[model samples]
Target: MDNYGGHIGQGRARDSQARRDAVTVEIGYALCSALFLAVVVFGVVAGPALAFELSDTVQGTLVASGATLGAVLFTVRVVSVLNRFAREGDSTDGDQPSQPGRTNPDS
Candidate 1:
């Protein structure tokens, strides 16, 4: 009887681990999607704008502004993806305790 109980407890703990893995996978997908969008937008919108604005701004300012915008957008995109992955992983890991080892002392 004790062995059976331990087996069941271990199974529950395994389930919790599987849930954590699933959350990590989901976060990876989300990060990929976000990066894809960033690439598309940067190519279609920012690329063209920067190209056209080349002649409008003073030569130095045009280069500076373009460089600044590019850096800012890239930073935002990278930080957002990293933050999402970290936050999701943390939340999922924190939310589940292995059912196997946990017990109420009062009980």
Candidate 2:
């Protein structure tokens, strides 16, 4: 029984660590994306005004890069928000007791 309890505890610890790892990865990705976007935008907007004028090719490249980055960040944010709402809806629905006479629309 003691050994079984120890195994259960270890399992819980592993599960907790997995969750932490997932969160860390998510944060890292978000930070890297934001940093990249900031750098690209700054280079395009500030670099030219500061006397470090970029060539036409470089300017166009920067503009395209910034647009792509902005789109990707926007999509990620929207998806995460939608996922959060979905998760919240699921939990709330689960918490509610079902009425005997009523049927779930989802079911």
Candidate 3:
């Protein structure tokens, strides 16, 4: 009905399916990267306690702090990554047509 004659595909369903697949891939990537980041952060924070003979209290504190910080970072990373994806998608939505199409019924 509009210019450029719809997307060059079998149908809207195909495009929708492709988009879903792309989103799934991106989500998987985000989660995997976030987990890796969390693990690394935890290891760095707790490394000294684990390596050297520290007091029980000190070790526990370090371990707990590490876990908390790692969890926070993991959450932030995932949210930020997904937000970025959403923002990028916003830009490409609804192709901008040079030639206007379809007049308003009321107007």
Please, what is the TM-score per model?
Answer: 0.45, 0.43, 0.78
For TM-score, the strongest prediction is 3
Q: Ten residues in a row with the worst lDDT in model 3?
A: 1-10
Per-residue lDDT tens digits of candidate 1, residues 1-107?
23445644675586689878876776677567656755665555446555675555565564555566655666676677767767856665543453757863224
List the candidates ranked by TM-score, beginning with the highest.
3, 1, 2
Worst 10 residues of 1 by lDDT: 1-10
Which lDDT value does model 1 have at 73? 68
Question: Which 10-residue window of candidate 2 scores lowest in summed lDDT?
Answer: 88-97
Q: Which one is best on lDDT?
A: 3
Give the C-alpha lDDT of model 1.
0.61
Of 2 and 3, which scores higher on lDDT? 3
Pairs of residues at least 3 apart in sequence or in different chains that clash in candidate 1: none
